[model samples]
Target chain A: MRLIGKEEIENIAIGAALLGTGGGGDPYIGKLMAIQAVEENGPIRLLSLDEVPDDALIVPSAMMGAPTVMVEKIPSGHEALAAFKSLKDFLGQEIYATMPIEAGGVNSLLPLALAAQIGLPVIDADGMGRAFPELQMVTFYLEGASATPMVLSDEKGNSLLLNTIDSVWAERIARSVTVEMGGSVMNAIYPMEGHFVKKASIKNILTLEEEIGRTVREAMKQNINPIEDVLELVGGTALFEGKVTDINRRTEGGFAKGTATIDGLNKNKGSDCRLHFQNEHLLCEVDGKVRCVTPDLIAVVDSETGMPITTEGLRYGARCTVIGIPCDEKWRTEKGIATAGPRYFGYDTDFTPIEQLNAKAGITK
Target chain B: MRLIGKEEIENIAIGAALLGTGGGGDPYIGKLMAIQAVEENGPIRLLSLDEVPDDALIVPSAMMGAPTVMVEKIPSGHEALAAFKSLKDFLGQEIYATMPIEAGGVNSLLPLALAAQIGLPVIDADGMGRAFPELQMVTFYLEGASATPMVLSDEKGNSLLLNTIDSVWAERIARSVTVEMGGSVMNAIYPMEGHFVKKASIKNILTLEEEIGRTVREAMKQNINPIEDVLELVGGTALFEGKVTDINRRTEGGFAKGTATIDGLNKNKGSDCRLHFQNEHLLCEVDGKVRCVTPDLIAVVDSETGMPITTEGLRYGARCTVIGIPCDEKWRTEKGIATAGPRYFGYDTDFTPIEQLNAKAGITK
Candidate 1:
């Protein structure tokens, strides 16, 4: 186990935003919340997957709702504590630790803040190595971990404990309820034993986020571009370098759904890339050719600073570099593809690995 | 306590439909479900408010969704049992008896059916003596009874336990979740102790329903018109005798919302009446003037047989009689009016007692 202090939170926030793939929520708010929590409660303890016992119960905590709504209605911190306590009370078991359901801006750091405040260790793992919009788009879900008994607590002291038949139903009901509960709520979900955690979770996600954050920060300090290091760290391909030309966004059904159009620069000058997203970037196309799709991670970072930009942060005329990382092997399975593949999101394209698409296009570093 | 048999089930269904105020659900379905349960489980024991101990827990069970949806998707008896059992498990206390949250076609009978299945007693009390649309539109809410910790269960083995700061939030969240759960789900809501039940509930609502049912049945058997007797029984007014000329309805936001226009017949031949509803009839206007408004109950029944017709059952060219009943004294309070009056339902008229409106129009038995 290692201690997650202010520096780790800062780095994790930056890395989480990078992996968040233009969704999750703003890292700035999560960063401030985590910093304040650490200042008041000291460093948070983070346990690796192997450190937890097989019988120990682990619950992942995060915020669920449209990132746009989250921007206006920041959580009051009490919500997370209430959700965890409610779930713990319902299970009648002591939670060994808390973790992130997905690695995203607010989601990844919220657990650290919660762990610090409640004096519990955070598992250095997450259900998704990168953010996905729906609840079932997690590696744990692909590995058959139940997404309930999940507790959702709003800022106004209302809470719901949902026990659904499947993760899909959980997503449907919880998403609608989230929209009703002022468009956002804190969730304590996917309670699993440590053994299941080891089996289902994407291990060392927090550590990876920290490493990405540190890489970006250090590279910036030395006045060098960090895009190559960031891409290499995630085993990702620099898909396109561009200036954002247009964006179409709408907050619907508790999700920030939209697309960003990027005008390619330098090597990709003739090709314009379109990034489609429902909260997180789900698809990427270069000049009308599929480059990357969901079950793959797509991130947009400042070309110079290499700091990640969320979907909400995308602006006209902003110079950015887009990267695509292969998802965890679990998501490549047939069931995972069926669960969150292009078809599920109403895309016409079939599942194809990002590297294969890049190789076909003869685009290499 | 009294034993409720199949005969009582039949009678309660008729009365529940009447008190449902042209909303709730169809009585025929609830009648069949309750009768079947009685055949299998013998009889359901119904306890009076006086019989319940002060500390005894009393949960009210009902179905939430548009009546139109309920007509198509009948709940399997398992949903109510699941909801009650889930709530019982959550509270960790043996629920003494179950009651109805509102007196409606399906809601009033659902508790009886559940009681029989679980071998739990039924309480003769209900939160609303007559049904209203929203969850918070109950006398219990005015008395400050919480609408949760409540459980909602769908036929597909999914359940949610909600705890809200107030009844309004409970209605908001539960309504959205109900829509997500296939537009209709069984709810175990407004859990209260016996003392609070007595204080908050409209007492002996089931008993009154049975009496209304018996009066109508006996009158029908003797070939006497049941309209006058029904009105006298409930201290209600015969507001209009008419034929349904038009109905404008759309099921939206988990509610059957619309208005029915009736062309007056007999003494009211020259006038036209408009009946407005959101699940339950909230307003009635005769010749473009407000006649009866909610928290008062407005019900439409067959002019020949006096059988109540649900909002969904309202049809064009059907000869009908519209009656208005004075609400419980508790509902005449300021808080009650603000919670469920005509204004609350978006009608411009102020809440006037049905008796006052009847006197003003010179409509008397």
Candidate 2:
């Protein structure tokens, strides 16, 4: 285990925003929340997955609802504690650590903030190496992990403990309840024993996020573009270089769903790219041809700073570089693909590797 | 204490339907569920509020959703047991008895069925002496009794335990969850100590329901119209006698909300009556002038047999008599009226007691 102070939180937030693709939540807000928490309560302890004993209990914490609403209805710090306390009481077992369900945007750093305040270690593994919108879109779910007994606690002191037959049901019921609880609520979900978590989780996600964040920060200091380093680190492909032209977004069914258009720039001139998202980037198309789809990471970064931009922060006329990182090996499996593939998001396409799509376009760097 | 067998269920169903005031749930379905439970587990014990020890725990069981949905999606009986067990476990104490949140339609009989199956006593008291759509529209709520720690269980082995800041929040959140859980779910709610039950609940509500049922059944047996006898028993007035002409109904936001129009007959042939409801009848008018409005009770019964008709049972051509009963004294106070008054249900009038409305209409009988 090692300590994670404000610096670590800042670096993690940048990487989280990139992995978050176009959704999850705003990394800046996540950074502020984590920094304040660390400042108030001291550095947090982050344990590697291997360090957790088999008998230890780990409950991942998250915020569930539309990312749009999350910005305005900031969690009151106490909501996470309330959720953890209620879940721990319900399980009648002491929780050994907390972690993020996804290593993306705001969710990746939320557990760190919570750990600092609650004085618990945050496990370094996450269910999703990046992020997906729904609760069931996780490697743990693909491995047959149940998303409940789960607890959702709002800032209003209202909480609900849900026990569902399957993870999908957990998603449906919890989504509606989250909407009712005013768009966003904190969750203590997917309580698992360390043995099962070690088997099911994508390991070293936080460490990778920190590396990516540090790479971007150092590159910016040296007046260099960090996209090349980021691509090499994550085995990612630069899909498009573009200037944002238009965005159409609406908050619907507890999700911020929309399509964003980016006009091509630099080497990708004369081509236009369309990115579709529901909380996270789900599908990306360049010149009307699919380049990357869900279960694959699609991130947009500032062309100059290489700083990741959240979908909430994506405005028109921004010069950016869009990249596609290959997802974890676990997500390439049939079950994983079926759970969060392009088809699952209502796109009429089968799962295809981002590298394969990149090669077909014949512009590999 | 006494035993409640099939006969008692039959009588209570009738009276429960009457008090249900055109909402609650279908009486026939409630009777069948209770009868089956009694046949399998013998008679259920009936305990008056006075019989419960001061510190004994009481949990009321009911079904929440649009009445229209409850008809098609019959519960599998296990839902209530699951709800009760969950709530009992959460409280970590043996529940002394189960009661009804409302003494109306299916809600009134659901507790009896659950009592038989769980072998717990059924308290002869209820939060609402009659039915109202929302959870907080009860005497218990007026007395500041919380509607949670509550458990909502569905037939699909899903359950949610809720703890809200207030009863209104409970109603808002639970109602949305009910809609998501296939539009209906069983609930164990408003847990109270015996002393609090005695203070907050409407006493002898089940007994009153039974007496009204007996009156209607005996009147049918004697081949006489039971409306007068029923009126006398509940201190109600015959509001209008008519044949159903027009009914507009829609299930929205987990409630069966609509209006029904009746063409006058006999002494009231020249006039028309209108009834408005959101789960229960909340407003009644004759030719545009307001008559009986909630928290007063308005029920429709078959003119010939004097058998109560649920909102679900209201047919386009059914000959029916509309009756208005004075609500329990608890519902007449400022808090009570504010909780379920005419304006609360979107009617544009102040609450006028049924007696005053009836006297103004020259229907002293």
Candidate 3:
């Protein structure tokens, strides 16, 4: 186990937001909460998935609802711990550690914050290597893990324990409750034994976040191209360097869905790129040719600062660098493609590896 | 304790529908479920509140959501029991009996159905003497009862247990969940001791329902005026006898709200009455004069059959009789009026007793 202090939280938040791929919710508030928790309860221990005992009980946590709402109605900071305790009590067993449901945005910090507050260790792995909109989109779910016996808590000391037959139903029910609990809530779900956790989780995501975050920060400090550093660290390729020209967004069935157009700049000056998103950036097209789709990371970052821009924060006129990175090998499996591929988002295309797409376009470094 | 059999469910359903005042949802499905449960598990016992032991644990049950949705998605007949078992496990205490959260429509029969299925007795009382749209509008809430530690369950074996600061928050949170859970679910709430149950509940509402239902059914069979029999049985007065000339309705924020205009006929010809409602009928104005408002009962029944007409079922050109009955004395208390009076429903007027309004209008019989 490695000790995680306040400084590391900033790095993780930055890196997680990058992996968030324009969804996951903003990380500033969650970062502050984690900082406070660590200050009060001392540093948290970060444990590798392999280090956990085979019988150790693991609980993954996240914040569920509209990201826009979270920005306005700040959490009470106690909801996560409340949900954790409620679930622990329900199980009548001691939880060995806490883990992130997804390695993206604010949720990446929630489990860390909860672990610090409760004096527990956070697992180094996560359910999703990158963010997906729904609860059932996690690798744990695809690997046959159930999200039942979930606990949901709100700011006003209100908590609900949910049990569903499947993870999809868990998402559907918890989502409804989240909307009712004033549009946002903290949830503890996917309780599992260490054996299952080791098999289902995306290993070493915490380390990857730290590496990505540190690389970007150092590049920014040195006045180097932060985008180039991020691309090198994540083995990504710059898909488009442009200024956002237009954005059209609407919330349907509790999801923010939209399309954004970006006018290419500098070397690729006359071309245009478009992004289609449902919560997370799902598809990226350059001059009407699809370059990347879901299950492959499509990140839009600030041109200068290299900070990830959430879908809710996307605005016209912002200069951005869009990058495409290959997802973990686990997500390339047939089951994984079927779970979160282009077709799942209602597009008529199959999963195409980002590397192949980038090489075919002959725009390599 | 008194035994309740399948035969009595019809009478209670009829009377409870009248009490629903246009909302609480249709009672036909709930009544059928109750009949099936009784046939399968034998007759259920109905206990007087006074007879309950001081420490007896009583849990009230009800169905919450849009009445329109309930019609399309029939229940799986196991949600209420699922919620009950979940809550029971959480409380870690033996539940003594079941009771209705309200004496309106389907909710009135839920406790009976639950009791029959579980072979437990049902209390002969309810939280609301007549239906009100919100969970916090119950007499129990006005009497200082908390709706926390509540359990909500859907037909898919999904359950949620909520703990909130007060009943209002519980309602707000539960209503949101209801919408998410396909617009309706069963809830078991306000688990109180026997002593509190007796003080908070509208006593003997089950008996009242049976009496009102039997009176109406018998009058129809005997070729007597069913409307007159209903008014006499409930000590109500004829507010208006008319043909439904116009009906306008809309659902807002999950509640069915609307207005109906009736043209007076026969002895009451040459005048019109208008009823404004939110879930339950909240106000009635006859000949441009306010005659009855919330904290009183406003019921619309078929002119010929004396069958209660729900707000969702109100159609233009239907011949109807409108009646206003005095609410239970408990509802006239300052706290009760403040909880569900005219002003509570956004009306500008203070609550005026139905009897006084009838007297002023010179329509006493």
lDDT by residue (tens digit), candidate 3, B56-139: 888988888876677787666688778888888889999999898887677888788888877789989998888887888887
Candidate 1 lDDT tens digits, B273-323: 999988888899988877889998998889988888888889999999988
Give the clashing residue pairs of candidate 2, or none.
A23-A279
- Can you list the residue pairs that collide in candidate 1? none
RMSD to true structure for each model, in Å = 2.3, 2.0, 2.7
Better of 1 and 2 by DockQ: 2
Please report how far candidate 2 places residue B349 from its true position, in Å.
1.2
Model 3 lDDT, residue A203, Cα: 91
TM of each candidate vs. truth = 0.95, 0.96, 0.93
Compared with the true structure, all predictions reach lDDT values of 0.88, 0.89, 0.85
For residue B61, give model 2's deviation from the true position in Å: 0.3
Residues A1-365, candidate 3: write the lDDT tens digits: 89988889889989999998988888787788788888888998999988999999999988889877887876666887788889999999999999998867678987888898777899999988889988888888888989978988888788888888788888887887787787888888999999999999899898888888887888788877688778888888888888999999998888899999999885652379899999999999998888888899999999888988888778989999888989987788898898889998898888999988887888665
**Candidate 2: TM of chain A?**
0.96
Q: Chain B alone: TM-score in each candidate?
A: 0.95, 0.96, 0.96
Candidate 3: where are CA atoms >4 Å away?
A226-229, A242-256, A260-271, A301-320, A363-365, B226-229, B266-270, B302-306, B312-319, B363-365
**Total clashes in model 2, counting residue pairs 3 or more apart in sequence or in different chains:** 1
- Residues A142-169 of candidate 1 have per-residue lDDT tens digits of 8888899999999999999999999999
Model 3: colliding residue pairs: none
